[model samples]
Target: MAAAARASARARPLAHPNPGVAALLVKDGCVIARGWTQEGGRPHAEAVALAGLGDGGAEGATLYVTLEPCAHQSARGPACTDLVIAAGPARVVIGQLDPDPRTAGEGAERIRRAGIAVTVLDDANARASLSGYFTRAEFSRPHVTLKLAMSLDGCIAMADGSSQWITGEAARAHVHAQRARHDAILVGGATWRADKPRLDVRLDGLEARSPVRVLLSRGVAPDGVRVINRPSQIGDLEGVQYLYVEGGAVAAASFLAEDLVDELHIYRAPILIGEGRRGLADIGLTNLADAHGRWRASEQRQLGSDTFSAYLRSR
Candidate 1:
Protein backbone atom coordinates (compact mmCIF):
# COMPACT_ATOMS: atom_id res chain seq x y z
CA MET A 1 0.00 0.00 0.00
CA ALA A 2 2.86 2.39 0.74
CA ALA A 3 4.47 1.66 -2.61
CA ALA A 4 1.12 2.29 -4.28
CA ALA A 5 0.97 5.74 -2.72
CA ARG A 6 4.45 6.59 -4.04
CA ALA A 7 3.46 5.48 -7.54
CA SER A 8 0.43 7.77 -7.42
CA ALA A 9 2.70 10.78 -6.99
CA ARG A 10 3.57 10.52 -10.68
CA ALA A 11 -0.12 10.86 -11.61
CA ARG A 12 -0.70 14.00 -9.60
CA PRO A 13 -1.64 17.52 -10.81
CA LEU A 14 -2.77 15.93 -14.08
CA ALA A 15 -5.37 13.50 -12.78
CA HIS A 16 -7.65 16.38 -11.84
CA PRO A 17 -11.34 15.66 -11.25
CA ASN A 18 -10.03 12.18 -10.42
CA PRO A 19 -7.86 11.15 -7.52
CA GLY A 20 -4.31 10.18 -8.43
CA VAL A 21 -4.31 6.44 -7.89
CA ALA A 22 -1.84 3.58 -8.18
CA ALA A 23 -2.05 -0.20 -7.97
CA LEU A 24 0.25 -3.11 -7.33
CA LEU A 25 -0.35 -6.82 -7.65
CA VAL A 26 1.72 -9.15 -5.51
CA LYS A 27 2.03 -12.93 -5.55
CA ASP A 28 3.82 -14.74 -2.72
CA GLY A 29 5.45 -11.45 -1.60
CA CYS A 30 6.86 -10.78 -5.08
CA VAL A 31 5.36 -7.93 -7.11
CA ILE A 32 3.66 -9.00 -10.31
CA ALA A 33 2.47 -5.67 -11.75
CA ARG A 34 2.45 -1.94 -10.99
CA GLY A 35 0.67 1.00 -12.58
CA TRP A 36 -0.46 4.56 -12.04
CA THR A 37 -3.18 6.74 -13.55
CA GLN A 38 -2.41 8.06 -17.02
CA GLU A 39 -2.71 11.54 -18.44
CA GLY A 40 -6.30 12.82 -18.65
CA GLY A 41 -7.18 10.25 -15.98
CA ARG A 42 -8.20 7.49 -18.34
CA PRO A 43 -7.27 3.82 -18.07
CA HIS A 44 -7.18 3.85 -14.27
CA ALA A 45 -4.34 2.34 -12.27
CA GLU A 46 -6.12 -0.97 -11.71
CA ALA A 47 -6.91 -1.32 -15.41
CA VAL A 48 -3.34 -0.58 -16.37
CA ALA A 49 -1.93 -3.04 -13.88
CA LEU A 50 -4.34 -5.79 -14.89
CA ALA A 51 -3.37 -5.34 -18.53
CA GLY A 52 0.24 -6.00 -17.59
CA LEU A 53 -0.51 -9.27 -15.82
CA GLY A 54 0.88 -12.38 -17.50
CA ASP A 55 -0.49 -15.92 -17.47
CA GLY A 56 0.76 -16.06 -13.86
CA GLY A 57 -2.04 -13.56 -13.55
CA ALA A 58 -4.12 -12.16 -10.68
CA GLU A 59 -5.95 -15.28 -9.57
CA GLY A 60 -5.40 -15.76 -5.83
CA ALA A 61 -3.07 -12.75 -5.81
CA THR A 62 -3.29 -9.74 -3.52
CA LEU A 63 -3.85 -6.24 -4.88
CA TYR A 64 -2.77 -3.02 -3.22
CA VAL A 65 -4.22 0.28 -4.34
CA THR A 66 -3.74 3.86 -3.18
CA LEU A 67 -7.49 4.55 -3.23
CA GLU A 68 -10.53 2.31 -3.36
CA PRO A 69 -11.11 1.23 -6.94
CA CYS A 70 -13.70 3.55 -8.43
CA ALA A 71 -17.15 2.02 -8.78
CA HIS A 72 -18.60 4.67 -11.09
CA GLN A 73 -18.85 3.40 -14.60
CA SER A 74 -18.81 5.87 -17.47
CA ALA A 75 -18.46 5.83 -21.25
CA ARG A 76 -15.07 7.46 -20.77
CA GLY A 77 -13.67 4.46 -18.89
CA PRO A 78 -14.58 1.03 -17.50
CA ALA A 79 -15.47 0.71 -13.83
CA CYS A 80 -12.37 -0.14 -11.83
CA THR A 81 -14.34 -2.31 -9.42
CA ASP A 82 -15.70 -4.40 -12.26
CA LEU A 83 -12.25 -4.92 -13.68
CA VAL A 84 -10.80 -5.81 -10.27
CA ILE A 85 -13.61 -8.33 -9.62
CA ALA A 86 -12.93 -10.06 -12.90
CA ALA A 87 -9.19 -10.16 -12.16
CA GLY A 88 -9.88 -12.63 -9.35
CA PRO A 89 -7.64 -11.13 -6.70
CA ALA A 90 -7.98 -12.94 -3.37
CA ARG A 91 -7.59 -9.72 -1.37
CA VAL A 92 -7.54 -6.00 -1.97
CA VAL A 93 -5.79 -3.51 0.31
CA ILE A 94 -6.74 0.15 -0.14
CA GLY A 95 -4.79 3.06 1.27
CA GLN A 96 -7.81 5.30 1.47
CA LEU A 97 -11.44 5.70 0.32
CA ASP A 98 -12.40 7.62 -2.76
CA PRO A 99 -13.82 11.06 -1.98
CA ASP A 100 -15.91 11.46 -5.12
CA PRO A 101 -19.61 11.68 -4.37
CA ARG A 102 -20.38 8.73 -6.61
CA THR A 103 -17.69 6.39 -5.36
CA ALA A 104 -17.05 7.50 -1.78
CA GLY A 105 -17.30 3.99 -0.32
CA GLU A 106 -19.23 2.09 -2.94
CA GLY A 107 -16.16 0.74 -4.70
CA ALA A 108 -14.89 -1.23 -1.74
CA GLU A 109 -18.42 -2.39 -0.86
CA ARG A 110 -18.92 -3.78 -4.34
CA ILE A 111 -15.60 -5.64 -4.26
CA ARG A 112 -16.41 -7.16 -0.86
CA ARG A 113 -19.84 -8.34 -2.05
CA ALA A 114 -18.02 -10.34 -4.71
CA GLY A 115 -16.49 -12.45 -1.82
CA ILE A 116 -13.02 -10.92 -2.13
CA ALA A 117 -11.42 -9.71 1.09
CA VAL A 118 -11.11 -5.93 1.12
CA THR A 119 -9.24 -3.92 3.76
CA VAL A 120 -8.88 -0.15 3.92
CA LEU A 121 -5.69 1.03 5.61
CA ASP A 122 -5.26 4.48 7.11
CA ASP A 123 -1.85 6.15 7.21
CA ALA A 124 -0.40 9.66 7.24
CA ASN A 125 1.52 9.13 3.97
CA ALA A 126 -1.58 8.00 2.10
CA ARG A 127 -3.59 10.96 3.39
CA ALA A 128 -0.91 13.40 2.28
CA SER A 129 -0.72 11.79 -1.15
CA LEU A 130 -4.47 12.27 -1.61
CA SER A 131 -4.57 15.75 -0.08
CA GLY A 132 -5.10 17.51 -3.40
CA TYR A 133 -8.11 15.48 -4.47
CA PHE A 134 -9.53 15.48 -0.95
CA THR A 135 -9.34 19.27 -0.78
CA ARG A 136 -11.03 19.66 -4.14
CA ALA A 137 -13.83 17.29 -3.21
CA GLU A 138 -14.43 18.77 0.25
CA PHE A 139 -13.72 22.47 -0.30
CA SER A 140 -14.37 22.71 -4.06
CA ARG A 141 -11.02 24.47 -4.51
CA PRO A 142 -7.64 23.17 -5.55
CA HIS A 143 -4.99 22.53 -2.88
CA VAL A 144 -3.10 25.81 -2.61
CA THR A 145 0.64 25.91 -1.78
CA LEU A 146 2.26 29.28 -1.17
CA LYS A 147 6.02 29.46 -1.94
CA LEU A 148 7.99 32.40 -0.57
CA ALA A 149 11.73 33.06 -0.98
CA MET A 150 13.23 35.50 1.46
CA SER A 151 16.24 36.64 3.52
CA LEU A 152 17.12 35.73 7.11
CA ASP A 153 15.71 39.06 8.31
CA GLY A 154 12.21 38.14 7.06
CA CYS A 155 12.62 40.30 3.94
CA ILE A 156 11.75 39.17 0.44
CA ALA A 157 13.43 42.05 -1.32
CA MET A 158 15.16 45.40 -0.80
CA ALA A 159 13.37 48.71 -0.10
CA ASP A 160 12.65 49.26 -3.82
CA GLY A 161 10.89 45.89 -4.29
CA SER A 162 13.79 44.33 -6.23
CA SER A 163 14.07 40.66 -5.24
CA GLN A 164 15.60 39.08 -8.27
CA TRP A 165 17.99 36.63 -6.57
CA ILE A 166 17.36 35.98 -2.91
CA THR A 167 18.38 32.33 -3.02
CA GLY A 168 21.17 30.48 -4.88
CA GLU A 169 20.89 28.55 -8.13
CA ALA A 170 20.15 25.28 -6.31
CA ALA A 171 17.15 26.81 -4.56
CA ARG A 172 15.84 28.35 -7.79
CA ALA A 173 16.16 24.99 -9.51
CA HIS A 174 14.22 23.36 -6.70
CA VAL A 175 11.33 25.80 -7.19
CA HIS A 176 11.09 24.95 -10.88
CA ALA A 177 10.98 21.27 -10.02
CA GLN A 178 8.19 21.95 -7.56
CA ARG A 179 6.30 23.76 -10.32
CA ALA A 180 6.29 20.55 -12.31
CA ARG A 181 4.25 18.85 -9.59
CA HIS A 182 1.41 21.37 -9.60
CA ASP A 183 -1.56 21.64 -11.96
CA ALA A 184 -1.27 25.41 -12.18
CA ILE A 185 1.07 28.26 -11.16
CA LEU A 186 -0.58 31.48 -9.98
CA VAL A 187 0.85 34.97 -9.45
CA GLY A 188 -0.46 38.43 -8.61
CA GLY A 189 -0.35 41.40 -10.98
CA ALA A 190 2.44 42.95 -8.97
CA THR A 191 4.60 39.87 -9.52
CA TRP A 192 3.74 39.81 -13.19
CA ARG A 193 4.80 43.45 -13.67
CA ALA A 194 7.86 43.13 -11.48
CA ASP A 195 9.50 40.05 -12.99
CA LYS A 196 7.43 39.07 -16.03
CA PRO A 197 8.19 35.46 -15.12
CA ARG A 198 7.34 32.85 -17.66
CA LEU A 199 6.17 30.43 -14.93
CA ASP A 200 6.96 27.46 -17.14
CA VAL A 201 8.78 24.29 -16.09
CA ARG A 202 12.30 24.38 -17.51
CA LEU A 203 13.61 21.05 -16.28
CA ASP A 204 14.95 18.90 -19.10
CA GLY A 205 12.49 16.31 -20.50
CA LEU A 206 9.82 17.64 -18.10
CA GLU A 207 8.88 20.70 -20.12
CA ALA A 208 5.48 19.20 -20.81
CA ARG A 209 4.86 19.29 -17.06
CA SER A 210 4.73 23.10 -17.07
CA PRO A 211 1.51 23.91 -15.28
CA VAL A 212 -1.29 26.18 -16.48
CA ARG A 213 -0.37 29.82 -15.90
CA VAL A 214 -2.69 31.92 -13.72
CA LEU A 215 -2.86 35.64 -12.98
CA LEU A 216 -4.70 36.52 -9.81
CA SER A 217 -5.96 39.95 -10.70
CA ARG A 218 -9.11 41.75 -11.83
CA GLY A 219 -7.49 44.01 -14.38
CA VAL A 220 -6.32 43.22 -17.90
CA ALA A 221 -3.31 40.91 -17.79
CA PRO A 222 -1.00 38.86 -20.02
CA ASP A 223 -2.11 37.05 -23.12
CA GLY A 224 -2.15 33.41 -22.04
CA VAL A 225 -2.82 33.21 -18.32
CA ARG A 226 -6.06 32.47 -16.46
CA VAL A 227 -7.25 35.58 -14.64
CA ILE A 228 -8.99 35.19 -11.31
CA ASN A 229 -10.70 38.23 -9.81
CA ARG A 230 -11.01 36.95 -6.26
CA PRO A 231 -9.74 34.09 -4.15
CA SER A 232 -13.33 32.99 -3.42
CA GLN A 233 -13.64 32.18 -7.14
CA ILE A 234 -10.78 29.65 -6.89
CA GLY A 235 -13.35 26.90 -6.58
CA ASP A 236 -14.14 27.45 -10.25
CA LEU A 237 -10.66 26.56 -11.46
CA GLU A 238 -11.41 23.49 -13.48
CA GLY A 239 -9.02 20.53 -13.93
CA VAL A 240 -6.69 21.84 -11.23
CA GLN A 241 -5.93 19.57 -8.27
CA TYR A 242 -2.86 21.44 -7.04
CA LEU A 243 -2.39 25.20 -7.34
CA TYR A 244 1.06 26.69 -6.66
CA VAL A 245 1.32 30.33 -5.63
CA GLU A 246 4.60 32.20 -6.22
CA GLY A 247 4.05 35.57 -4.69
CA GLY A 248 5.07 39.18 -4.21
CA ALA A 249 3.54 39.72 -0.76
CA VAL A 250 -0.06 40.95 -1.35
CA ALA A 251 -0.98 37.86 -3.33
CA ALA A 252 0.46 35.53 -0.70
CA ALA A 253 -1.13 37.47 2.16
CA SER A 254 -4.54 37.54 0.45
CA PHE A 255 -4.68 33.76 0.18
CA LEU A 256 -3.47 33.35 3.77
CA ALA A 257 -6.06 35.85 5.04
CA GLU A 258 -8.81 33.95 3.25
CA ASP A 259 -7.57 30.71 4.81
CA LEU A 260 -7.01 29.24 1.36
CA VAL A 261 -3.37 28.26 1.82
CA ASP A 262 -3.05 24.53 2.57
CA GLU A 263 0.73 24.35 2.58
CA LEU A 264 3.57 26.83 2.96
CA HIS A 265 7.09 26.71 1.41
CA ILE A 266 9.62 29.08 2.83
CA TYR A 267 13.12 29.46 1.28
CA ARG A 268 15.46 31.54 3.37
CA ALA A 269 18.89 32.84 2.43
CA PRO A 270 21.67 33.46 4.92
CA ILE A 271 21.95 37.11 3.91
CA LEU A 272 19.76 39.78 5.48
CA ILE A 273 18.40 42.84 3.70
CA GLY A 274 17.64 44.82 6.88
CA GLU A 275 15.85 47.88 5.44
CA GLY A 276 13.63 46.06 3.03
CA ARG A 277 10.11 44.93 2.28
CA ARG A 278 8.75 42.29 4.63
CA GLY A 279 8.42 38.71 3.47
CA LEU A 280 4.87 38.54 4.84
CA ALA A 281 2.18 41.17 5.03
CA ASP A 282 -0.48 41.82 7.67
CA ILE A 283 -2.70 38.75 8.01
CA GLY A 284 -5.08 40.61 10.36
CA LEU A 285 -4.38 38.38 13.35
CA THR A 286 -5.09 40.00 16.73
CA ASN A 287 -2.79 37.88 18.86
CA LEU A 288 0.20 35.55 18.46
CA ALA A 289 -1.76 32.66 19.97
CA ASP A 290 -4.09 32.60 16.98
CA ALA A 291 -1.14 31.81 14.73
CA HIS A 292 0.27 29.07 16.94
CA GLY A 293 -1.95 26.21 15.85
CA ARG A 294 -2.38 27.32 12.24
CA TRP A 295 0.76 25.81 10.68
CA ARG A 296 3.07 22.92 11.62
CA ALA A 297 6.51 22.50 10.12
CA SER A 298 6.92 19.21 8.31
CA GLU A 299 10.32 19.52 6.60
CA GLN A 300 13.47 21.58 6.88
CA ARG A 301 16.61 21.13 4.78
CA GLN A 302 19.71 23.07 3.86
CA LEU A 303 20.42 23.96 0.25
CA GLY A 304 23.88 25.53 0.15
CA SER A 305 23.53 28.87 1.95
CA ASP A 306 19.69 28.70 1.88
CA THR A 307 17.26 26.90 4.14
CA PHE A 308 14.11 25.26 2.76
CA SER A 309 11.13 24.89 5.06
CA ALA A 310 7.81 23.14 4.44
CA TYR A 311 4.71 23.49 6.60
CA LEU A 312 1.25 21.98 6.50
CA ARG A 313 -1.87 23.64 7.83
CA SER A 314 -2.87 22.30 11.26
CA ARG A 315 -6.46 21.69 10.35
Candidate 2:
Protein backbone atom coordinates (compact mmCIF):
# COMPACT_ATOMS: atom_id res chain seq x y z
CA MET A 1 0.00 0.00 0.00
CA ALA A 2 2.84 2.41 0.83
CA ALA A 3 4.51 1.83 -2.50
CA ALA A 4 1.21 2.32 -4.31
CA ALA A 5 0.59 5.50 -2.35
CA ARG A 6 4.06 6.86 -3.20
CA ALA A 7 3.57 6.09 -6.89
CA SER A 8 0.16 7.80 -6.86
CA ALA A 9 1.69 11.15 -5.87
CA ARG A 10 3.18 11.53 -9.35
CA ALA A 11 -0.28 11.20 -10.91
CA ARG A 12 -1.78 14.03 -8.82
CA PRO A 13 -1.48 16.99 -11.23
CA LEU A 14 -2.35 14.92 -14.29
CA ALA A 15 -5.42 12.97 -13.14
CA HIS A 16 -8.19 15.50 -13.67
CA PRO A 17 -11.51 14.04 -14.98
CA ASN A 18 -10.12 10.63 -13.92
CA PRO A 19 -8.89 9.22 -10.65
CA GLY A 20 -5.14 9.28 -10.10
CA VAL A 21 -3.97 5.70 -9.64
CA ALA A 22 -0.64 3.88 -9.27
CA ALA A 23 0.51 0.27 -9.22
CA LEU A 24 3.58 -1.69 -8.25
CA LEU A 25 4.57 -5.35 -8.76
CA VAL A 26 6.82 -6.81 -6.10
CA LYS A 27 8.42 -10.26 -6.05
CA ASP A 28 10.40 -11.82 -3.23
CA GLY A 29 10.20 -8.54 -1.27
CA CYS A 30 12.06 -6.73 -4.08
CA VAL A 31 10.41 -4.08 -6.26
CA ILE A 32 10.33 -5.06 -9.92
CA ALA A 33 7.75 -2.93 -11.76
CA ARG A 34 5.91 0.39 -11.18
CA GLY A 35 3.59 2.62 -13.19
CA TRP A 36 1.10 5.48 -12.87
CA THR A 37 -1.90 6.62 -14.93
CA GLN A 38 -0.57 8.65 -17.83
CA GLU A 39 -2.11 11.88 -19.15
CA GLY A 40 -5.09 11.65 -21.55
CA GLY A 41 -6.20 8.72 -19.33
CA ARG A 42 -4.56 5.94 -21.34
CA PRO A 43 -2.13 3.21 -20.39
CA HIS A 44 -3.68 2.79 -16.91
CA ALA A 45 -1.45 2.12 -13.93
CA GLU A 46 -2.18 -1.61 -13.73
CA ALA A 47 -1.62 -2.15 -17.46
CA VAL A 48 1.71 -0.32 -17.38
CA ALA A 49 2.98 -2.24 -14.34
CA LEU A 50 1.81 -5.60 -15.65
CA ALA A 51 3.38 -5.02 -19.05
CA GLY A 52 6.72 -4.35 -17.34
CA LEU A 53 6.70 -7.85 -15.78
CA GLY A 54 7.05 -9.83 -19.06
CA ASP A 55 6.44 -13.59 -18.77
CA GLY A 56 7.59 -14.19 -15.17
CA GLY A 57 5.49 -11.20 -14.09
CA ALA A 58 2.63 -12.34 -11.86
CA GLU A 59 3.59 -15.95 -11.08
CA GLY A 60 4.85 -15.16 -7.57
CA ALA A 61 4.44 -11.38 -7.31
CA THR A 62 2.25 -9.18 -5.16
CA LEU A 63 0.46 -6.27 -6.84
CA TYR A 64 -0.08 -3.04 -4.92
CA VAL A 65 -2.66 -0.70 -6.41
CA THR A 66 -4.00 2.61 -5.15
CA LEU A 67 -7.58 1.82 -6.15
CA GLU A 68 -9.53 -1.34 -6.77
CA PRO A 69 -8.90 -2.64 -10.26
CA CYS A 70 -11.60 -1.70 -12.73
CA ALA A 71 -13.96 -4.46 -13.92
CA HIS A 72 -16.00 -2.74 -16.62
CA GLN A 73 -15.25 -2.48 -20.33
CA SER A 74 -14.73 0.81 -22.13
CA ALA A 75 -13.88 1.95 -25.65
CA ARG A 76 -10.41 2.92 -24.49
CA GLY A 77 -9.37 -0.52 -23.24
CA PRO A 78 -10.32 -3.82 -21.59
CA ALA A 79 -11.27 -4.23 -17.95
CA CYS A 80 -8.37 -4.11 -15.50
CA THR A 81 -9.81 -7.12 -13.68
CA ASP A 82 -9.24 -9.21 -16.80
CA LEU A 83 -5.63 -8.09 -16.97
CA VAL A 84 -4.93 -8.87 -13.31
CA ILE A 85 -6.64 -12.23 -13.59
CA ALA A 86 -4.51 -13.15 -16.62
CA ALA A 87 -1.30 -12.05 -14.88
CA GLY A 88 -2.28 -14.04 -11.75
CA PRO A 89 -0.58 -12.05 -9.01
CA ALA A 90 0.05 -13.92 -5.79
CA ARG A 91 -1.55 -11.21 -3.66
CA VAL A 92 -3.25 -7.85 -4.17
CA VAL A 93 -3.24 -4.86 -1.82
CA ILE A 94 -5.74 -2.14 -2.61
CA GLY A 95 -5.90 1.33 -1.04
CA GLN A 96 -9.60 1.89 -1.70
CA LEU A 97 -12.45 0.21 -3.50
CA ASP A 98 -13.63 1.92 -6.68
CA PRO A 99 -17.02 3.65 -6.33
CA ASP A 100 -18.05 3.79 -9.97
CA PRO A 101 -21.38 2.01 -10.36
CA ARG A 102 -19.98 -0.40 -12.92
CA THR A 103 -17.15 -1.67 -10.71
CA ALA A 104 -17.90 -0.89 -7.05
CA GLY A 105 -16.78 -4.05 -5.14
CA GLU A 106 -16.96 -6.42 -8.06
CA GLY A 107 -13.31 -5.83 -8.99
CA ALA A 108 -12.11 -7.06 -5.61
CA GLU A 109 -14.50 -10.01 -5.67
CA ARG A 110 -13.21 -11.08 -9.06
CA ILE A 111 -9.61 -10.96 -7.86
CA ARG A 112 -10.30 -12.86 -4.60
CA ARG A 113 -12.37 -15.51 -6.40
CA ALA A 114 -9.38 -16.09 -8.67
CA GLY A 115 -7.41 -17.50 -5.67
CA ILE A 116 -5.38 -14.36 -5.03
CA ALA A 117 -5.06 -12.75 -1.60
CA VAL A 118 -6.71 -9.33 -1.34
CA THR A 119 -6.23 -6.70 1.35
CA VAL A 120 -7.78 -3.24 1.63
CA LEU A 121 -6.07 -0.50 3.66
CA ASP A 122 -8.39 2.37 4.49
CA ASP A 123 -6.12 5.26 5.50
CA ALA A 124 -5.95 9.08 5.35
CA ASN A 125 -3.41 9.30 2.52
CA ALA A 126 -5.47 7.16 0.15
CA ARG A 127 -8.61 9.10 0.90
CA ALA A 128 -6.91 12.45 0.32
CA SER A 129 -5.37 11.37 -2.97
CA LEU A 130 -8.67 10.11 -4.40
CA SER A 131 -10.96 12.68 -2.76
CA GLY A 132 -11.92 14.60 -5.89
CA TYR A 133 -12.79 11.49 -7.89
CA PHE A 134 -14.74 9.88 -5.08
CA THR A 135 -16.58 13.07 -4.30
CA ARG A 136 -17.70 13.48 -7.89
CA ALA A 137 -18.89 9.87 -8.11
CA GLU A 138 -20.83 10.01 -4.84
CA PHE A 139 -22.41 13.42 -5.45
CA SER A 140 -23.13 12.93 -9.17
CA ARG A 141 -21.40 16.16 -10.12
CA PRO A 142 -17.91 17.51 -10.55
CA HIS A 143 -16.08 18.38 -7.30
CA VAL A 144 -16.31 22.17 -7.50
CA THR A 145 -13.63 24.51 -6.11
CA LEU A 146 -14.03 28.30 -6.15
CA LYS A 147 -10.71 30.14 -6.63
CA LEU A 148 -10.32 33.85 -5.91
CA ALA A 149 -7.34 36.21 -5.66
CA MET A 150 -8.12 39.45 -3.92
CA SER A 151 -6.79 42.31 -1.80
CA LEU A 152 -6.67 42.15 2.01
CA ASP A 153 -9.86 44.21 2.06
CA GLY A 154 -11.54 41.45 0.00
CA CYS A 155 -11.77 43.43 -3.23
CA ILE A 156 -11.06 41.42 -6.37
CA ALA A 157 -10.65 44.25 -8.84
CA MET A 158 -10.80 48.06 -9.07
CA ALA A 159 -14.02 50.03 -9.58
CA ASP A 160 -13.30 50.52 -13.26
CA GLY A 161 -12.64 46.78 -13.69
CA SER A 162 -8.96 47.43 -14.36
CA SER A 163 -7.74 44.35 -12.52
CA GLN A 164 -4.27 43.21 -13.45
CA TRP A 165 -1.79 41.08 -11.54
CA ILE A 166 -3.37 40.87 -8.11
CA THR A 167 -0.78 38.29 -6.96
CA GLY A 168 2.88 37.85 -7.82
CA GLU A 169 4.23 35.45 -10.47
CA ALA A 170 4.82 32.70 -7.92
CA ALA A 171 1.19 32.83 -6.78
CA ARG A 172 -0.03 32.85 -10.37
CA ALA A 173 2.13 29.81 -11.09
CA HIS A 174 0.68 28.08 -8.07
CA VAL A 175 -2.80 28.82 -9.40
CA HIS A 176 -1.83 27.21 -12.73
CA ALA A 177 -0.72 24.10 -10.84
CA GLN A 178 -4.14 23.95 -9.23
CA ARG A 179 -5.75 24.32 -12.66
CA ALA A 180 -3.85 21.25 -13.86
CA ARG A 181 -5.58 19.08 -11.28
CA HIS A 182 -9.10 19.96 -12.40
CA ASP A 183 -11.00 19.04 -15.57
CA ALA A 184 -12.60 22.38 -16.25
CA ILE A 185 -11.76 25.99 -15.37
CA LEU A 186 -14.59 28.55 -15.40
CA VAL A 187 -14.91 32.33 -15.43
CA GLY A 188 -17.71 34.85 -15.67
CA GLY A 189 -18.78 36.28 -18.99
CA ALA A 190 -17.54 39.66 -17.82
CA THR A 191 -14.06 38.32 -17.05
CA TRP A 192 -14.08 36.42 -20.32
CA ARG A 193 -14.84 39.64 -22.24
CA ALA A 194 -12.41 41.74 -20.23
CA ASP A 195 -9.33 39.58 -19.83
CA LYS A 196 -9.70 37.16 -22.75
CA PRO A 197 -7.66 34.77 -20.64
CA ARG A 198 -6.28 31.42 -21.71
CA LEU A 199 -6.70 28.92 -18.89
CA ASP A 200 -3.84 26.55 -19.78
CA VAL A 201 -1.14 25.04 -17.55
CA ARG A 202 2.25 26.63 -18.30
CA LEU A 203 4.67 24.70 -16.08
CA ASP A 204 7.96 23.63 -17.67
CA GLY A 205 8.42 19.93 -18.60
CA LEU A 206 4.68 19.52 -18.13
CA GLU A 207 2.89 19.26 -21.45
CA ALA A 208 0.31 22.04 -21.61
CA ARG A 209 -3.00 20.57 -20.45
CA SER A 210 -5.59 23.27 -20.93
CA PRO A 211 -8.60 22.98 -18.73
CA VAL A 212 -11.82 23.20 -20.76
CA ARG A 213 -12.64 26.91 -20.67
CA VAL A 214 -16.11 27.49 -19.32
CA LEU A 215 -17.92 30.81 -19.57
CA LEU A 216 -20.96 31.50 -17.42
CA SER A 217 -22.97 33.14 -20.15
CA ARG A 218 -26.56 32.48 -21.02
CA GLY A 219 -25.94 33.10 -24.68
CA VAL A 220 -23.47 31.63 -27.12
CA ALA A 221 -19.83 32.01 -26.15
CA PRO A 222 -17.12 33.55 -28.33
CA ASP A 223 -15.63 31.91 -31.42
CA GLY A 224 -13.72 29.17 -29.58
CA VAL A 225 -14.99 28.99 -25.98
CA ARG A 226 -17.22 26.64 -23.96
CA VAL A 227 -20.14 28.13 -22.10
CA ILE A 228 -22.53 26.77 -19.50
CA ASN A 229 -25.65 28.84 -18.99
CA ARG A 230 -27.10 26.79 -16.15
CA PRO A 231 -25.40 24.80 -13.44
CA SER A 232 -27.27 21.69 -14.52
CA GLN A 233 -25.80 22.10 -17.99
CA ILE A 234 -22.51 20.72 -16.70
CA GLY A 235 -23.99 17.26 -17.09
CA ASP A 236 -23.35 17.46 -20.83
CA LEU A 237 -19.57 17.35 -20.37
CA GLU A 238 -18.54 13.69 -20.85
CA GLY A 239 -15.78 13.07 -18.30
CA VAL A 240 -15.62 16.17 -16.12
CA GLN A 241 -14.57 14.73 -12.77
CA TYR A 242 -13.47 18.05 -11.28
CA LEU A 243 -14.53 21.66 -11.85
CA TYR A 244 -12.58 24.78 -10.84
CA VAL A 245 -14.62 27.98 -10.68
CA GLU A 246 -12.34 30.99 -11.03
CA GLY A 247 -14.41 34.08 -11.40
CA GLY A 248 -15.59 37.59 -10.88
CA ALA A 249 -18.32 38.31 -8.33
CA VAL A 250 -21.39 37.50 -10.45
CA ALA A 251 -20.19 34.09 -11.56
CA ALA A 252 -19.23 33.14 -8.00
CA ALA A 253 -22.70 34.05 -6.78
CA SER A 254 -24.34 31.98 -9.51
CA PHE A 255 -22.69 28.72 -8.47
CA LEU A 256 -23.13 29.45 -4.78
CA ALA A 257 -26.83 30.06 -5.25
CA GLU A 258 -27.14 26.71 -6.95
CA ASP A 259 -25.23 25.09 -4.06
CA LEU A 260 -22.72 23.90 -6.62
CA VAL A 261 -19.42 24.86 -5.02
CA ASP A 262 -17.49 22.05 -3.22
CA GLU A 263 -14.21 23.81 -2.36
CA LEU A 264 -12.83 27.34 -2.17
CA HIS A 265 -9.34 28.73 -2.87
CA ILE A 266 -8.71 32.31 -1.84
CA TYR A 267 -5.42 34.16 -2.38
CA ARG A 268 -5.26 37.35 -0.31
CA ALA A 269 -2.82 39.97 -1.43
CA PRO A 270 -1.45 42.14 1.41
CA ILE A 271 -3.16 45.27 0.12
CA LEU A 272 -6.60 46.81 -0.11
CA ILE A 273 -8.95 48.04 -2.82
CA GLY A 274 -11.76 49.36 -0.66
CA GLU A 275 -14.65 50.49 -2.90
CA GLY A 276 -14.00 48.17 -5.77
CA ARG A 277 -15.38 44.74 -6.70
CA ARG A 278 -15.91 42.33 -3.82
CA GLY A 279 -14.55 38.80 -3.90
CA LEU A 280 -18.04 37.37 -4.04
CA ALA A 281 -21.31 38.79 -5.26
CA ASP A 282 -24.54 38.44 -3.31
CA ILE A 283 -25.15 34.70 -3.30
CA GLY A 284 -28.10 35.26 -0.96
CA LEU A 285 -26.13 34.29 2.14
CA THR A 286 -28.53 35.83 4.66
CA ASN A 287 -25.78 36.59 7.15
CA LEU A 288 -22.18 35.85 8.05
CA ALA A 289 -23.44 33.28 10.54
CA ASP A 290 -25.24 31.46 7.72
CA ALA A 291 -21.91 30.86 6.00
CA HIS A 292 -20.01 29.89 9.12
CA GLY A 293 -19.60 26.13 8.86
CA ARG A 294 -20.03 25.65 5.11
CA TRP A 295 -16.28 25.41 4.61
CA ARG A 296 -13.26 24.14 6.54
CA ALA A 297 -9.77 25.43 5.95
CA SER A 298 -7.67 22.72 4.30
CA GLU A 299 -4.42 24.48 3.34
CA GLN A 300 -2.64 27.78 3.67
CA ARG A 301 0.57 29.03 2.07
CA GLN A 302 2.44 32.25 1.31
CA LEU A 303 3.45 32.86 -2.31
CA GLY A 304 5.68 35.88 -2.66
CA SER A 305 3.50 38.91 -1.71
CA ASP A 306 0.33 36.88 -1.45
CA THR A 307 -1.25 34.49 1.05
CA PHE A 308 -2.99 31.50 -0.53
CA SER A 309 -5.63 29.57 1.40
CA ALA A 310 -7.79 26.59 0.42
CA TYR A 311 -11.07 25.58 2.06
CA LEU A 312 -12.94 22.36 1.51
CA ARG A 313 -16.69 22.23 1.88
CA SER A 314 -17.70 20.45 5.06
CA ARG A 315 -19.71 17.40 4.16
The total of clashing pairs for model 2 equals 0
Q: Candidate 1 regions off by >4 Å?
A: none
In candidate 1, what are the lDDT values of residues 227-290, reduced to their tens digit? 9997777888888889999987898999999999999999999997999999778877889888
TM-score of 2: 0.88
User: Candidate 1: minimum summed lDDT over ten consecutive residues — where?
Assistant: 11-20
Question: Model 1 compared with the native: what TM-score?
Answer: 0.96
Across 47-104, the per-residue lDDT of candidate 2 in tens digits comes to 9899887775688899988889999999988898999999998999888999887998
lDDT, each prediction: 0.89, 0.83
Clash pairs detected, candidate 1:
none
